[model samples]
Target chain A: MRINLASIHVDDQEKALRFYTDVLGFLPKNDVPMGEHRWLTVVSPEEPDGVELVLEPDDHPAVRPYTEALVADGIPFTSFAVADVHAEFDRLKGLGVTFTQEPTVMGPVTTAVLDDTCGNLIQIAAMEAPAS
Target chain B: MGDVFKALADPTRRAILDELQERNGQTLFELCTRLISKHGLSSSRQAVSQHLDVLEAAGLVHTRREGRYKFHDLDTSPLRTITDRWQLPTD
Candidate 1:
């Protein structure tokens, strides 16, 4: 099964959409009417038509506590694969993205961690060659 | 229609992941055998296959097609997305 997208609830839809699309280069995949809240989503250009990131509205009662607890506990909600951690890290840094961790070698893979400003610690990594 | 949380929201998927954490890598049959009995699940092979499909689509798991056996393992890339999206401070 191929995952098409990951979803995150946001306090401000427009602001979050801008950060994801304008700042991170994800293209809008879905933006349609959904009662009071619009069904919005985005996808990475690099993985053309790959996973879609669903931008959910944080109107639910659990959102505030969920987002706050995750941040307070320093728990990363998800991760992604990258061809090159250093390059991606540098490129994002150039864009003024604040990183909480630098690239570092870990056992079989080299990885770097960054803050998405949206309340998550995204990791970029270069996976080791497939086990022979 | 993917719920975005379609694959992850299930406790079964989470359990499958917890199992993967220990095994790291396993074929579909292996995972089923190992987990089926333990979880007391009464699903057919097709049902497990469907679940695996969801997991694969979510990018939470990776599968490599080998001759007759498809090897599966956890893919942590989307985990970064979850982490970043959650903005968890790792100090």
Candidate 2:
């Protein structure tokens, strides 16, 4: 089955909109209103026709504790694959995105973690093996 | 916020953070109840306590005691710093 949409819970939809678009550089794809919350979604600028990232509200009572436990244990809520860990790290750092981990190579891959500000720790990773 | 909140890079911690954010001052027992009922997390107090220790060490969570009551408070300045960076000029 092909993946189409993935959702990330946010404390505030507006904040998620700004952070996902401005800091992470994703483009807003859908903004239809859904009662108190909007049917919001974002797409990578490079993949407008590809997968969409839905910014859902963390209104459910369970969301806070679910996210809090993960944060306390130093685990990322989710991860993103980037072209280059070092470059993306520096780029995000330059944009004032705080990183919990630096680009550390682990065999064939490298990874780093950053706070999403809307109550999530997001990891950006990349493959590091040289092409033959 | 980066160094102090390094442990905060986890979603579970973010949720615990909400407890502190909402109540500002809570006992460990209160935190446990919130985690179980609110987030549906089944972690025991010991497991949740460990998370608090990490946050406490990072200065993101502070504790105070008045008489027999022990309270925990969340410091959001560091969290605010993260959002500050993303405050780009909106069109």
Number of the top DockQ candidate: 2
Q: Give a tens-digit lDDT track for model 2, residues B27-51.
A: 5655765677677788888888888
Report the C-alpha displacement of residue A39, candidate 1, in angstroms.
0.9
lDDT of 1 at A30: 91
Best by lDDT: 2
lDDT of 2 at A99: 61
The local lDDT score (0 to 100) that residue A59 gets in candidate 1 is 89
lDDT of 1 by residue, A1-132 (tens): 776768887777778788788877788889998888889998878876788888888888988788665543233456678877888888899999865445655456766655566655555778766767
Residue B90 CA error for candidate 1 (Å)?
41
